[model samples]
Target: MRRQTQECKEYMEAGEKYLDCQDRQLTSVMQDWPKDINHLLLARNKIQVLRDNMFSQFTQLKSLDLQQNDISMVEDGAFSGLSQLTTLLLQHNRLKTASEEVLLPLPRLTYLRLYDNPWSCQCSLDSLVRSLQLPSNRNLGNYAKCAEPLLVVGQKLKKLSVDSLCRDDNQVDRGTGGGDGGRPRLPLIKVKPEATSMCHTYVFPKLLLDCSNKDLDHIPSDLPSDIVKMDLSSNIVKHLRPKQFLLSKDLKLLNLSGNSLRHIDTAAFAGLLYLRELDLSNNSLHYFQYGVLEDLYFLRKLSLGNNPWVCDYNIHYLIYWLKHHPGVSYTGLMCSEPQEFRGWRVEDYVKTYNGECPKDRQTGGMDTGQGGQGGSDNEAQEVAGETGEQLPRPLREKKRNRFEIIRLS
Candidate 1:
């Protein structure tokens, strides 16, 4: 092992393959590091921004420790050329946001420590959040948390609803130039304090309303009609009446998780034709009306996890709907009732039941297999219950020992 100067010490161990420069009060990385060094410790330094290709010379590096530093910004491609890197420690830093481009180069990375940094929750972090959801990074879920946007200050980043992080690019007009070249701009409309007290709204550029965790009994009635996204999770909303969202026709995302929603009327979401995502997890819902979700033709993502679902003939409609719409991504639609079907995934339940309702019960002349092809929408609604017959094959798959649903309630 070779030791450097007194202020900055460098030692090599295990045949000159490891380097330790920790607690050296260094402001920048040493350019003279051994090219063969496989482990480098630079924690407790004064390093700020990480410029692009800063570690390009450390091609053989397998583990890099930079924790407890003052690193706030990591320029795109800063970690290029460290393809062999397997472990990276970046905890306890000043990083507020991380982009996918910054971490995409480390294909061999198996362990990453990114906790203790202040993270800003916004559209810019959407890519990072999605990348972390991959099965390979599932272990990092608990280590990531939001530090800004007070509404979700201490919540885990992975647990945050996707709608909260994704913002519609077209809704926000970012360009300063107007149609009339260089004309004088009109006075801006100042938002009132009352609006802020009810919910946080960003009026400039575009409108975003956040009313989550506010203990609200109902949706705010004074919101602007053009608002693009709204979060109403963790509240006391019990029921959704007809045309409940008529005023917010332009809303593209809605979050109603962790609420006391026991009933949702047929036309509860009638006016939200453009809604792209909806979260109804962690509620008291037993069954959704047969056609309650038919209007959400544009919805691409839906979360129905952690609810007490009654898996009976009433649930056949949902199964039929899910089977036909392969484009929709959903999670946690498992059975919680009906002793025979408990814990079975909704999709599996549909397959096991084969759209056949129990013969002993009456279905009020409703179609159990609504999404089957060759059946018109009118036929789907008018068909009566299945004839009393033998049950379809039961699910022979092993039951899940632990549910993956997140309990927000």
Candidate 2:
């Protein structure tokens, strides 16, 4: 049995010239080291540590993989021996810090992957991102962020604007009371002197314009001609210009959820003959004319939940649309009816209050939508609570205004 086991091990090592240690339950040292090995994959091992000279014998190795490990640290010069190595994968690791000191030795490494790692967003990380963006720098841009306070989880590094991603850090720290000596820690805005993407345009792909708490007071005028999906979720827009909405030919999805939008042009969405989903939730709209949303023939998913809806005769028109539009979904929106008539549904609303609105009550601009401020981590908690509920007042206030489609020219 002992000889058979030894033979099995020998055959396992000799059976193939390349070894894939990825996702292997490798917790300890292996018994035999194979020669002439060119590729070594040790990813997803759940390894926390690497011993000295782990791969010293594989002198001909060209590619190495080590992803999805619990690796928080690397012993000094752990990979100093791989002279001909070109590709290295170290993504989804628990590395809090990785620097040139650990990587300056690899001469031939051209492609390296270190994305999806839990890198703490602090000044320490500043040096990392900057160095990575440098065209001449080595293996710096390979790493991606694991947790950003704003963007989706595990997003690619090259896709997101670093300025926007880093902006939330200072604001996040300020709310934690990390202030020194009683000084208020104002959030730091990420400044990108050169903010531009490689114009990889797809004819009006979905516009992921998440300008929540940005310095933009207006919209960029040069919207793509085939913008089928538009997301203006959080910005300080006061109004939608005629060119902003009316000119787009194939706008299918429109989201004006959180802005300062008080009113929309009755003809604001003239050219959007193919609009399907329209979200106007959490705005400063006290009244909406029926003609505003009438042209949306393809509009199926309509959201108007959090606006300070003054359940009046005008609401009857919107309710009439909702009652007929089977695809329309009104998620968790509420109305403050007169003292006696509260908690109204869309079906009954048009029946009893069609062309009928509450006139006597003097309407004041109530909390924009719900109590929510910008740049506060607590505001994130508040938004979490309103996920399917009313739109946060702060986000609503930013959407009311529009710009001349400001281009980055």
lDDT of 2 by residue, 1-409 (tens): 1122212222233343456554457764365746556766665577887655666677677777676678877665677777877767665677755555455556777766665566654444554565566676544444355354423334445444456544555554544555455666545445221111111112111333233455344555545454466666676677765546655677787777788888776777777879888888878776667777677777777777777666666667666666677776666345555434457654565566434334322123324234354444454455446443333344454443343211111
Find the 10 residues in a row with the least total lDDT in model 1. 384-393
CA deviation > 4 Å runs, candidate 1: 5-9, 12-16, 168-409
lDDT of 1 at 362: 35
lDDT against the true structure, per candidate, is: 0.72, 0.57
Compared with the true structure, model 1 gives a TM-score of 0.40
Superposed on all Cα atoms, model 1 deviates from the true structure by an RMSD in Å of: 19.4
Alpha-carbon shift of residue 166 in model 1 (angstroms): 2.4
Worst 10 residues of 2 by lDDT: 195-204
User: Candidate 1: lDDT over CA atoms?
Assistant: 0.72
TM for every model, in the order presented, reads 0.40, 0.37
- On lDDT, the leading prediction is 1
Which stretches in model 2 have alpha-carbon errors above 4 Å? 1-212, 354-409
Deviation in angstroms for 195 in model 1?
36
Backbone clash count for every predicted candidate, in the order shown: 0, 30
Model 1 over residues 1-409: C-alpha lDDT tens digits?
5666444445655554667777888777767766777877777789898899999999998888887789999988989999999777776788888788977889988767666678887787777877777778754433556776545565667677767676642222332446556555444444222221345443222346677888888765545466688888999999998887887888998999999999999899888889999999999988888878878878899899999999888888777777777788898899899888899887787687664544444334434343343443443333322332322213334454353321111
